[model samples]
Target chain A: MLYLIGMGLHDERDLSLKAVEALRGCERVYLESYTSCFNGDINRLQEMLGKEVVLLDRKDLEENPEENVLAGGEVGLIVMGDPMVATTHSDLVLRAREKGAEVKVIHSSSVYSAIAETGLQIYKFGRTTTIAYPEGDYFPKSPYEALKENHMRGLHTLLLLDVKADEGRYMTVNEGIKYLLMMEESCLQNQFKKDSKCVGVARLGGDTAIRYGTAEEVIKEEFGGPPHILIVPGKMHYMEEEMLKAYEV
Target chain B: MLYLIGMGLHDERDLSLKAVEALRGCERVYLESYTSCFNGDINRLQEMLGKEVVLLDRKDLEENPEENVLAGGEVGLIVMGDPMVATTHSDLVLRAREKGAEVKVIHSSSVYSAIAETGLQIYKFGRTTTIAYPEGDYFPKSPYEALKENHMRGLHTLLLLDVKADEGRYMTVNEGIKYLLMMEESCLQNQFKKDSKCVGVARLGGDTAIRYGTAEEVIKEEFGGPPHILIVPGKMHYMEEEMLKAYEV
Candidate 1:
C-alpha cells in the first residue's frame, strides 16, 4: 500500500487525525523531504507518529528509491503540506496505481487558499507561479509576467516562493519583493497598473502566520525569512479594501 | 476571542490538532449550520471535541444573535469545513474584528483543493463558479457562462454547487450535471472543441469521495448525485490524461 499523507503548514501537530490514523497503520513510512520542510523539526513528528520515517529526496523520486521496500510490507509516502499540492508528485500516485499498489491520499493544509489570510478574494487569483532559480539579473521573470497578466485581466496572483531546502536557500520575503520589483522594471519598464496595492503573506497555516500589506512602495520595506508569497491584486471589491485596513500596511 | 476553526473533510476525525486544541478551550461554540453539513452527525464532533455546540443559521449573521453569546467570553466559531472556504462569511470576521475581537483562523482541509480528488490539475482550473438559485427558465446561467469561458481558454472550471441550508437546498451532482449538460449543448451545438469532456466530483474530502470520469461517453450513460461539482477540463497534460485512465471512467 502506498499512502500519501500531508504534514500541513510547518508543524507536526497540524497533521489531521486521519493522517495520524493512516500513519499508524503503515508498516514502513517514507517522507518526501525535498519539496518542503517543517516549521518545527522532523524529530517531533518522528516521536509523535511513533514510527521511523525514512527521508526521500528528489533523487529518490527520479530513481525510485525504496520502490522495493514496499514489496514485502506496507509503505506510507508522506508529503509535507498537502499531498496533492504538487502536480509532479501526483504522477507518483499514478505510478503506484500502475503497479497495482493500493493508494490513499491523506489531505492537509496548503498555501493555495491560505491566501485568504490576506483577506484577498480567493476566486480572483489567476495561474499560480513560484520564484525559481535565479540565473541572471532576475529570478522570477516568468512569475512576474504571469502576475502582470493576471492583474491585466483583473485577477489576483499567488506567488509561491522557491524552496530548495537541502541547498539551504529558501527565498525570503525581502529578497522576493526586491527581485519582483526589479523584474517588473525590466519586464515592462513603466507600463504597469497600480502596483501600490499588494499583500505579503508569511508562515501561512502556522499559529502566528502573518498577512499584511506591502503594496508597491512598502514592499521595499524589510521582512525576514523563507516561505512568503507576494500578491498583486487585480480588481478589489470595496469590502476587500476595508479588510486591508485591519492589516498593518 | 473568536476563532473560526475549520473541521476539514467529512467527520470529526479529520480535525487538525490546532482546531482540536481550540475546540477544547472554547467556552461556547456556535456552529454555522447554513454553511455546511458534516458527512456525519453533529454528535460525532460533540463526542470528539467533548463540547456542547449551538447551531447558527443565516439570521444569526444578519441580526447578531451571537452578540451576547461571544461578547465577554472565550468563543469559538466552528464551520462544517474550512471557515474561509466560503468567502460569504468573511464579513463575520470583519464584523468581529470591528468589536475589538481577536480572531484567529485555524486552518483545516477544505474542498477547494480537495477537489483535486478528481485528479485534475489545480493550475488548469480557471475562475471557479457556483450554481445559483434555479429561478424560472434559468438555473443560474452565470456559472454556465463562467465554465464556458474557462473551457474556451483551455482551462478547467470548478463548479461549486450552491448551498442554501435555510431552504435545505444543497445542489446535488445529478442536478448540477443536468444543468451543465444543457448549457454545454447550447454552447457547443456544433461542438467548438474536440469533445465536451467533463468530470463529476462527488463528496470531495469525504472518505467515500469519488472522481469518476464523465468526459467520456460513459459518464453520460452512468450519471449519479448530492454534494458534488462538475469539472470541464480544458487541455489535458499527458500525465493528467494517464492519471484519469486509472479511474472507472
Candidate 2:
C-alpha cells in the first residue's frame, strides 16, 4: 500500500488527524521535498509520528517511484500541502496503481485553497500560474500571459512563487513583482500600469502577512519571508472591495 | 479570539491536529453548515473533540454573525473544507476583525485543491462556477456563461454542485450535467456538444469515484452519492490524458 499523505500548510501539527493515524500505520515514510515549502522540521514530524521519514527529491519520485512503491508493507509518501495538487504526484499515483500497489491520498490544507485568506473570492479566481526564477536568458512568460488573460476575463489570478525547497531558495513577493513588471515592459502590452492594484500575501496558512495596494505601493513594501503569493485581482465585487480594505496594509 | 477552522473533506477524523487542539481550547464551537457538504456526523465530531458543536445556518452567519463573533473567549467557527473558500466566511473574518476580535484561520483540504485528484492540472482550471437548483423564472445562466468563457480560453471548468446543507439538498453530478446541457441548448451556442468529454468526480477526499467520458455518456452514469463535482476539461496535456485514462470508467 502506498499512502500519499499531505502534511498540511504550516507545521507538523497542521496534518490532519487521519493523516497522523495513517502515518502511524506506515512502515516507511518518504517526504516529497521539491513541490512546495513546508515550514516544519522533519525531526519534529518524526518525533510525532515515531517513523523515520526519508526525503525524496524530484528525481526520486519523477524518475524512480517503483523503488518507493514496491517497498513491501504500507509505504507513506508524505507531500507538503495536498498530495495531488502537483500533477507530478498524480502521475505518481498512476504509476503506483499500474505497479499493482494500492494507493490512498490523505488530503490536507494547501496554499491553493488558503489563498482565500487574501480576501479574494475563491470562485472568481481564474487559472493559477507560477512565477519561476529565470535561468540565464531562458525566462518563461507564461505566468504573465496567464495573468493577463485572467484579467481580460475579469477574474483574479493567483500567482504562486516558485520554490526550490532542497536548494533553500524561495521566490519573494518583491522579486515576483519585479519579474512581472519586466514581462510587461518586454511585451509592451500595457496590461498593467505602475498604479495597478495588487495584493501580496506572505507565509499563508501560518503567520500570514497580507498587503493590498497598487503595484507601485506593493512593490515598495516588504512582505517578510518565503512561500509568498501574489494576486492580480480583476473586477472586485462591492463586498470584496470592503473585505480587501480590511486587509490593506 | 475567533478561529475559523476547516474540518477537511471526509469525517470527523479529517480535522487537522491544529484544529483539534484549537477546538479543545475553545469555549464555544460553531460549524458553518451552508457552504459545502460535510459527510461527517456532527455528534461524532463533538464526541471526538469532547465539546458541544453548534450548527450555524446561513441566516445565523450571513445576517447575525455578531452573535457568533461576540461569544467571547476563543470562539471557534469550524467550516467544512478550507475555512475561507466561501466568500461569506471571508466576510465573517472581516466582521470579526471589525468587532475587535483577533481572527486566526486554520486551513484544511478543500475541493478547490482536491480537484487535482481528478487527474486535471490545478493550474489549468479557470473561474469555478456553482450550479444551483433552478427556481421559477430565475434560472441562472452565469455558470453556463463561465463554462463557455473557460472553454474559449482552453481551460478546464470545475463546476461545483450547489448544496443547501440546511435544507439537506445536495445537487448530484447528473443534475449538474443536465443543467449545463439545458443552458447550452437555451443559448443555442454549440459550446458543448452531446459528445463533448466531461469528468464526474464524487465524494472527493473520501472514498472517491471518478468517471471520464462524453457528456452524454457520463450523464447516464451513476456517480454514487452526493457532493459530486463536474469538470468540463479543455485541451488536455499529454500527461493529463494518460492520468485520466487510468480512471476512465
Candidate 3:
C-alpha cells in the first residue's frame, strides 16, 4: 500500500506512531519539502526513522522524476505538516492514482491547530497567508491582501513566511513585520488609513518560543526569531480580549 | 513549570518525544477532557507515559471544584490534537502566572492542515465553526452561517464536530452531515442557494480514514473511523479543482 504520511510540525518526534509505521513498512519513503518547513533538518529525521528517505521535492513531483518511486514497491510520500495541506501534493496523489497505486493517508499534526498553542483564539482567525521572500520585481501581495481582508472583517490573519528547501532559509519574524509595515506604508501613501494592528509569533509550536504583543511598537520589544508568523487581530470576543491581555508577555 | 503538551491526533505515540519528557518529569499531569475524544483511553496513555494522569474535565477549570494540581511541582496539561487548538489554555497560563508558576508549551499536530492534505487550498479557508449535536431547543445556525460566510467570500469553511467529554460521545461525519443538511434545508427555506458542496474527512491523521467526497455521500458510505472533519469548498483555485477531481473518492 502506498501511504502518504504527515511529519507534524517541528522535529522527528512530531511523527505519529502510525506515521512511524508507514516509514518502517514502506520499501521506498519520500519526504516532500515545498509546502512547509521542517524545523529539524532532514538528516536528523533520516537518522530517527533509521532510513535514507528519498525526497520528492517540488520539481520531483511536478516532473514525476523517477516514476518508479510511486509505481514500484510499497512507496510512501512523507510530507512535512500534512501532505494534503498544499494543492501541489494533491497533484502527486492524482498522478499516483493514475498509475494505479493504492494510496492512503496517515495524518499528522498541522500548524493550523498548532497556532492555538500560542494562546491565540482559533475562532478569531480569518484568512491565513504566507509572506514570501521579496523578489526583485515581484512583491509578496498575498500576505498583505490576507491581512487587509482579515482587518476589514475584524478577524485575525496568520502570516506564514517562506521556507527554502534548497537554501535552508526560514523567514524571520522581524522580516515579516517589516513587510507588513511596508504594505501599510504603501496603503497610507495611497490615501488609505493604516490603523490595523498586528501580533508577531516566533518559533510556533516549539518550546522557548515567544508569543508576545501586537503592532510595530509592541513587536519591537519582541524577538527576531525565525520560524515565525504574524497575526493581524480583527474583532475580538471578550474572552479573546481577556486572553490577549492575560497572555501578554 | 506548567507544561502544556499536545497529544497529537491519536494516542500516546502521537505525542512528540518532548511531550513525553515533560509528562515524565511533571508532579501532576492533567489531561483536559472537554476538548478531545481519544481513540485510545487514558489508561493506555498513563501506562505509556509512565505516569498517573488525571482527567481534568470542564468543571475543574470552568466551575470551582476546589482541587489544585498546579501547586505541587511541574504541572502538565495534556491536550488532544495540539495543546491550545480547541481551548485557550492561555487563560490557565495567565492563572498559573498569577500564581507565579512558569509555564512552558510543548506543541503537537492539529487537524487544521490535514484538510489541505485532503487537497483543499488552505488560504481559501474562512473562519471555522464546530457543529454541535442536535438539541431540542437548538436549531443551530453557527456551522451553516460559517459555511455561508465562506461561500459568500469565495473561501472554504472547516467544520469541526462537537465532542462530549464526560459521555465519551463524538459527533461522527454522518451526524455532522445531517447537521449540515439541516442547515442547508433552512438556507433553502430562506431562498438561499443551498448548493454548497462539502468534503468530509474521517479519522484525520489516522491509519484508515476517508479524506474526500461530499458529506451527504460520505454519510452514506461506511466510515468505521475515529475522528472526522468536513471541508465545505467555496470558490476553487485551478489547482484546487484539479485536486478535488484527482483525490475525490
Candidate 4:
C-alpha cells in the first residue's frame, strides 16, 4: 500500500489528524521536497508521527518512482500541499497503481484555496499561472499573457512564485513583480501599470503577512520571506474592496 | 481572538492538528452549517477535541456575527472546507474585526484544490461557478454560460453543486446535470451535448468515488449520495487523458 499524504501548508501541525494516524502505521515515509516550499521542521514531524522520514528530490519521485513504489509494503509519500495538485504526483499514483500497489490519498490544505485569506473571491479567480525565476535568457512571458487575458475578462489571477527548494531559492513577491515589469518592457504589452493594485501574501496558514497595494508600492515593500503569492485583481466588488482594506499597507 | 478553522472534507479526523489544538483552547466553538454539506459525525469531533461544538446558520453568521464574535474571549467558528473560500466567511471576518475582535484563520483542505485528484490541471481551470437547486422562477442560467465561456477558452470548469445543509438537502450530480441541460434548453444554447464528457466526483478526501463518462452516461449513472461536484474538462493533454482513464467508467 502506498499512502500519498499532504502535509498541508507551513508547520508539521498543519497535517491532519488522519495524516498523523496513517503516518504512524507506515513502514517507510518519504517527503518530496522539491515541489513546494515547506519550512516545517522534519524532526518535529518525525517526533509527532514516530516515523523516520527520508527526503526525496525531484529526480527520485519523477524519474524513478518505481524505486519508491516497489518497496512492496505500506510506503508513504508526503507531499507539501494537497498530494495530487501537481501532475507529477498524479502520474506517480498511476505508476504506483500499475505496479500493483494500492494507493490512498489523504488531502490537506493547499495554497490554491488558502489564497482566500487575502479576501479575494475564489470563484472570481481565473486560470492560475506561475512566475519562474529566469536563468540566463530562459525567461517565460506566458504568465504575463495569461494574467493579461484574465485582466481583460475582469477576473482575478493568482500568480504562484517559483520555488527551487533544493537550492534553498524561493522567488519573493518583489521578484515576481519585477519579473512582470520586465515582461511588460520586453513584450510592450500595456497590461501592467505602475499604479495597478495587487495583493502580496507571504507565509500563509501560519502567522501570514498580507499587504495590498499598487505594483509600485508592492514591488518596493518587503514581504519578509518565501512561499509568497501575488494576486492581481481585475474588477473588485464593493464588498471585496471592504474586505481588502484589512490587508492594505 | 476569533479562530475560523476548517474541518477539511468528510469526517472529524480530517481536522488538522492545529485546528484541534486551537479548538481545545476555544471557549465557544460554532460550526457554520449552511454553506456546504459536511456529513461528519459532530459527536465524534466533540469527543476528539473535548469541546462541545455549536451550530451556526447563515443568519447567525451574516446578520448577527456579534453573537459569535462578541464573546470577548477566544471563539472558534469551525467551517467545512477552507475557512475563507466562501465570501460569507470573508464578510464575517470583516464584521468580527469591526467589532474589535482579533481574527486568525486556520486553513484546511478544500474541494477547490482537491478536485485536481481527477487529473485535471489545476492551473487550467477558469472562473468556477455553482449550480443552485432551481427554486420556482429563481432558476439561474449563469452557471451554464460560465461553463460555455470556459469551454470556448479551452479551460476546465468546476461546477459546485449547491447544498441546503440546513434543510438536510444536498444537490446530487444527477440534478446538477439535469439543471445544466435544462438551462441549455431554455437559453436555446447548443452549449452542451448529450455525448459531452464530464467527471462526477463525490465525498472527496474520504472514501472518494470518481466516475468519468459522457453527460448521458454520467446522468444515468448513480454516484450514491450528496456533496457531489462536476468537472467539465477542456482540451486534455495526453498525460491528463491517461490519468483520467483510471476514473473512466
Candidate 5:
C-alpha cells in the first residue's frame, strides 16, 4: 500500500489525524520535498510520527519510483499541501497503481483554499496562475494573460509564487509583483499598475501576515517570511471590500 | 481567542493535530453544522476531543453572534472543510475581531482541493460553480454560464452540489448532472451532453466512490452517500486522460 499523505500548511503539527494514523501503519515514510517547501523542521515530524521520514528529491521519486517509492512493504509519501494539486503526484499515483500498489490520499489544507484567509470568496477565484522566476530569455506571459482574463470577468486571481525548493530559491511576493509590472510593460494593457490594489499574504496558517494595499504600497511592507502568495482583486462586492479593508496596511 | 478549525472532508479523524491542540484549549466548542454536513457521528467527535460539542445552526451564529459565537472564552468553532472558503465564515472572523476576540484559523482539507481525488489536475480547474435547487420558478443560469466559460477556456469545472444541512437536504451527483443537462437544454449550447465525459465523486476522504464516464453512464452508478461533487474535464493532457481512465466504472 502506498499512502500519499499531505503535510498541510505550516509544520508537522498540520498533519491530519487520519494522516498521522496512516503514517503509523506505514513501513516507510518518504517526504516529497522538492515540489513545495516544508515550513517546519522535519525532525519534529519524525518525532511525532515515530517513523523515519526519508526525504526524496524529484528525481528519486519520479525517475525510479519502483525502486525508491514502491520498493516494498507499505510506503507513505508525504506531500506538502494536498498531493494531487500538481500533475506530477497524480502521475505518480497512476504509476503506483500500474505496479499493482493500492494508493490512498489523505487530504490537507492547500494554498488553493488557504487564500480564503484573505477574506476573498473562494468561488470568485478564477484559474490560478504562477509567476516563475524568469529563466534566461524565456519570460512567459501566460500568468499575466490568466490574470487579465479573470480580471476582465470580474473574478479574483490568486497568483502563486514560484519555488525551486531543491535550490532553496523562492519567489517572494515583491518579486511576483515586479513580474506583473514587467508583464504590463510588455503588453501595456493596463492589467496591472503601480497603484493597483492587491493583497500580499505570507506564512499563512502560522504567524501569518496579510497586507492589503496598492501594488506599490504592499511591495514596501515587510511580510517577514517565505511561501508567500499574492492576490489581485477584480470587482469586489461591498462585503468583500469590507473584508479587504480589514487587512489594509 | 477564537479558533476556527476545519474538520477536513469526511470525519472526526480528519481533524489535524493542530486543530485538536486548539480544541483542547477551548472553553467551548461549537460545530457550525448548517453550512456543510458532518458524515461522522457527533458523539465520536466529542469522544475524541473529550469536549462536549455544541451544534449551532446558521441563525445561532449569524443572527446574534455576540450571544453565541462570541459570547465565550477561548471558543473553538469547528467548520466542516476549510473555514475561510465561505464568505459567511470570514464575516464571522471580522465580527469576532470587532468584538475584541483574537481569531486564528487552523486550516484543513476542503472540497476545493479534495476534488483532486478525481484524478484531475487542480491547477486546470477554472472558476467553481454551485448548482442550487431552483425555487419558485426562479432557476439561475449562472452555473451553466460559468461552466460554459470554463469549458470555452479549456479549463476543468468543479460543480459543487448544494447542501441544506439544516434541513438534511443534499443534492446528489445524479441531480447535479440533471441540472447541468437542463441548463444545456435551456441554453442550447452544447456545454454538456449525455455523452460528455465527466467525473462523479462521492464521500471523498472516506469510503470514497469515484466513477469516470460519460454523464449518462456515470449517473447510473450508486455513489452510496451525500456530499458528492461533479467534475467536467476540459481539454485533457494525455496524462490527465490516463489518470481519468483509472477511475472508469
Candidate 6:
C-alpha cells in the first residue's frame, strides 16, 4: 500500500484525524521536501505517528519511485498542503497504481483554499500564476501574461511566489511585487499598476498576516516571514471591499 | 472569540486536530448548513468532539449573527469544506470583527483544491462556476459564459454542481452535464459539444469515484451520490493527458 498524505497548511496539528490515523498504520514514511514548505516540526510529527519520517528529495521520488517509494510494504509519502495539487504526486499515484500498489490519498488544506482568508471570492479568481526568481536570462513572461488575461476579464489573480525549499530559498511577497513591477516594465502592459490595490498574505494557515493596499503601500508593510502569496484584484463587490477593510494598511 | 473551522472534504474524521481542539474549547458550536452538503454523520461528529453541534440556517446566520453566532462567547461555526471559500463566511468574519470579536480560521481541503484529484493542474484551471438547478424563469447564463471564457483561454473549468442541502436537492453529474448541453443549445456556441470530454468526481476525499469520458458517456455513468463535481477540459499537457487516461472509461 502506498499512502499519499497531506500535511495541510500549518504545524503538525493541522493534519486531519484521518491523516494521522493513516500515518500511524504505515510501515515507512517519507516526506516530499521540494514542492512546498512544510511548516511542521518533523520530529514532533514523527513522535506523534511513532515512525521515523524520512525526507524524500524530488529527484529520488520522481526518478526511482519503485525502489524508493513503492517497495512492496505499506509506505506513506507525506506532501505539503493537499497531496495531489502537484503534478508530480499525481504522476506518482498513477505509477503506483500501475504497479498494482493500492494508493490512498489523505486530503488537507492547500494554499488554493487558504487564500480565502484574503476575503477574495475563490470564484472571482482567474488562472493562478507563480513568479519565480529569474535565473540568468530565463525570466518568463507567462505569469505577467496570465495576470493580464485575468485582469482584462475583471477577475482577481493569485500570484504564487516560487519556493525552492531544497535550496533554502523562498520568494517573499515584496519580491513577488517587484517581479510584477518588472513584468509591467518589460511587457508595457497596463494590467498591473504600482497604485493598484493588492493583497499580501503571509504564513497562511498558521500565524497569518494579511495586508491590503496598493503595491506601493503593501511592499512597505512587513509580513514577517516566508511562503507569502500576493493577490492582484481586478474588481470587487461591496462585500469583498468591506472584508478588505479589515486588512487595509 | 469566534472560531471558523473547516470540516474538510468528507467526514468527521476529516476535521483537523486543530479544529477538534477548537471545538472542544468553544462554548457553543454551530454548523453552517446551507451552502454545501455535509457528508459526515452529525451524531458521530458531536460524539467525537463531546459537544452538541447545532445547525445554523442561512437566514439566521446572516441576519441575526450577533444574537445567534456572536453573543459574547467563544463560538465555533463549522463549515463544510474550507470555512471562507463562500462569500457568506467571509462576510461573517468581517461582521464579527466589526463587533470586536476575535476570529480564528482553521483551514481544510475544498473542492477548489480537491479537484486536483482529477489529475488536472490547479494553476491550469480558470474561474470556477456553478450550475444551479434552474428556477422557473430564473435560469442564469453566467455559467455557460464562464465556460466559454475559460475554454477560449485554453484553461480547464471547474463546474460546481449546486446543492440545496436544506431541500435535499444536490445536482448530480448527469444533471450538470445536461445543464451544459442546455447552455450549448441556448447559446449555439461551439464551446461545449455533446461529444466533448468531461470528468465527473463524486464523494471526494472518501469513497471517491472519478470517471472521464465524452459528455454522452460520462452522463450515462452512475456517479453514485450527491456532492459530485464536473470538470471540462480546455487544453491538456501530455502529463495531464497521461493522468486522465487512468480515469478514462
Note the DockQ of each predicted structure.
0.62, 0.84, 0.60, 0.90, 0.86, 0.87
Give candidate 5 misplaced runs (Cα > 4 Å). none
* Model 2 agreement with the true structure over B204-246: per-residue lDDT tens digits: 8888999998888888888877789999999999888988886
> In model 4 chain A, where is the ten-residue run with the lowest total lDDT?
A63-72
Ranking by DockQ: 4, 6, 5, 2, 1, 3
i-RMSD of model 4 (Å, 1 decimal)? 0.7
- Per-residue lDDT for A25-86 in model 5, tens only? 98999998787778889888899889798999888988988877888689999999988887
**Between candidates 1 and 4, the TM-score winner:** 4
lDDT of 6 by residue, A56-85 (tens): 888888898877787879888989899899
Candidate 5: give the clashing pairs.
none
Superior by TM-score: candidate 2 or candidate 6: 6
Docking level of model 1: medium
User: What is candidate 3's lDDT per residue for A1-249, written digit by digit as tens?
Assistant: 678787776667777766786688778778777666666677887787788887666777777635745666788788777667776667767777777777777776666777775566887788888888888988866676767666766677788878876777777766777777777676653211233455666655554354445554545555544566666676776656665664464
Q: DockQ winner among the candidates?
A: 4
Mark the 10 consecutive residues where model 3 chain B has the least summed lDDT: B189-198
Q: TM-score for model 5?
A: 0.98
Could you tell me how far off, in angstroms, the CA of residue B234 lies in candidate 6 after the best superposition?
Answer: 0.8
lDDT of 4 by residue, B184-226 (tens): 7888777767788899999998878899998899898788877
- Candidate 5 residues B100-196, lDDT tens each? 7888899999989888877777878999999999888988888889988999899999999999987888999999999999999999999999999
Poorest lDDT segment (10 consecutive residues) of candidate 3 chain A? A188-197
Give the Å shift of residue A55 in candidate 4: 0.4
RMSD score of candidate 5 (Å): 1.1
